[model samples]
Target: MTARVLVAGIGNVFLADDGFGVEVVRRLAGVELPAWAKVADYGVRGLHLAYDLAAADYELTVLVDATARGDEAGTVHVIELDTGRTEQTPCLDAHGMQPDVVLNLLAWLGEAPRRVVLVGCEPEVLDHRMGLSPSVERAVGTAAGAVVDLVTNHGR
Candidate 1:
């Protein structure tokens, strides 16, 4: 059967913790995922994300991104994007688009997933350099575990 839960990791790997999303997916690769969970490392490419939001068959989607939520470095936050409060909150990242944009666009296209959850991480450093910061690297496990929990519980 087609997957029921989609986990997308979005970020720019070259820019330190900007790659948090991708790194989380990488760490999750070693674990055994349910049959209905699908994951991908979608590096920075708005069009790519738009495509998946428009064309995927999953009923639920989990997106991981580097966010500035004023949390400590390596902090993992599980954000329910379906809530109304997120609509007015502006994201601190200038290069990235809000998760709402993806949901709204998919809704407009009549391809929206049944539910969407956003997993966010505060960046210790987003410098345009190679690799994740030490702190952010340490947070990968936490972020990956969060995704696993979300998918394993809701996936079926």
Candidate 2:
């Protein structure tokens, strides 16, 4: 069967560069996509995202977000996550936005997808402000393109 893919943009747009994911997905929505690829803006709802992952049956799920990776700002990264080995954790906040927490929760709920990937950018700042810095903003187009490539190549 052809893999079904979900491209999710995750972050809090109110926080400076942390809004990278949201912006990327917003841009991606304007692009043409394959029938098997789906895009969603999860913003800061980790638990809701977790449940959505659990409820849906997708073969590949790509998570796009701003990560605190120790790198130069606006740097884009693609990472493949190993699933099916999630550990049990305590209560979960349905509105949480951390990708790791949401993935762990999905594993806990026995809803981990077959394959997962993370496409993220290094944030220059994360403050209680709206809009992205120049560097991070520039990376959004690159990230969105990268995600489209991923979906087109992997989901078909």
Candidate 3:
């Protein structure tokens, strides 16, 4: 059976704190998840992610990434995107890992998951570093838990 949910961890690991999603997914590897769910680390592979979404009929696609919303670092936010609204014409960049761009590309391909959620963390450092800042590091577990909850509960 095809998976009903797709949990994608996207970001650039070379950039500090931007690797939050990658770290979270790595942690998720140790947790138990529903069989109908597929988890993957699609770091900076926006084109690949867009293709996957278009090829599958997943009901929900959860994107975990580092997002800056002017809040304190390490803060995690769960955002639900309105897939029906296409306010801006997204520009396609093969290397771009931004969630919106991937989703827009899915739409452009005439396919999209029924729902999209972004589990994001406020990044402390997006510099050329290999690891996350202290605060962002601490939030990795929380974000992983959030992803599990969202998928297990089917986004309830």
RMSD per candidate (Å) reads 3.7, 2.0, 1.5
Clashing pairs in 3: none
Q: In order, what lDDT does every prediction score?
A: 0.77, 0.87, 0.90
Candidate scoring better on TM-score of 2 and 3? 3
For model 3 the local lDDT of residue 84 reads: 63
Residue 39: error of model 3 in Å? 0.5
> How well does each candidate superpose onto the true structure, as a TM-score?
0.83, 0.93, 0.94
Q: Candidate 3: which stretches are off by over 4 Å?
A: 85-89
For residues 36-83, could you state the per-residue lDDT of candidate 2 as single tens digits? 788999998887788888888888899999987799999999999877
Query: What's the count of clashing pairs in each model shown?
Result: 0, 1, 0
Candidate 3 lDDT over 1-156, as tens digits, reads: 579999999999999998999999999998989899999999999999988888888899999999999999999999998776455667977666998888777777667679999999999999998999999999998999899999999946
Q: Between which residue pairs do clashes occur in model 1?
A: none
**Model 2: colliding residue pairs:** 46-96
Better of 1 and 3 by lDDT: 3
Query: Looking at model 1, how many pairs of residues clash?
Result: 0
Candidate 1, residues 13-85: lDDT per residue as tens digits?
8888888998898888898998778888877755567567677667778899888899898888898876222
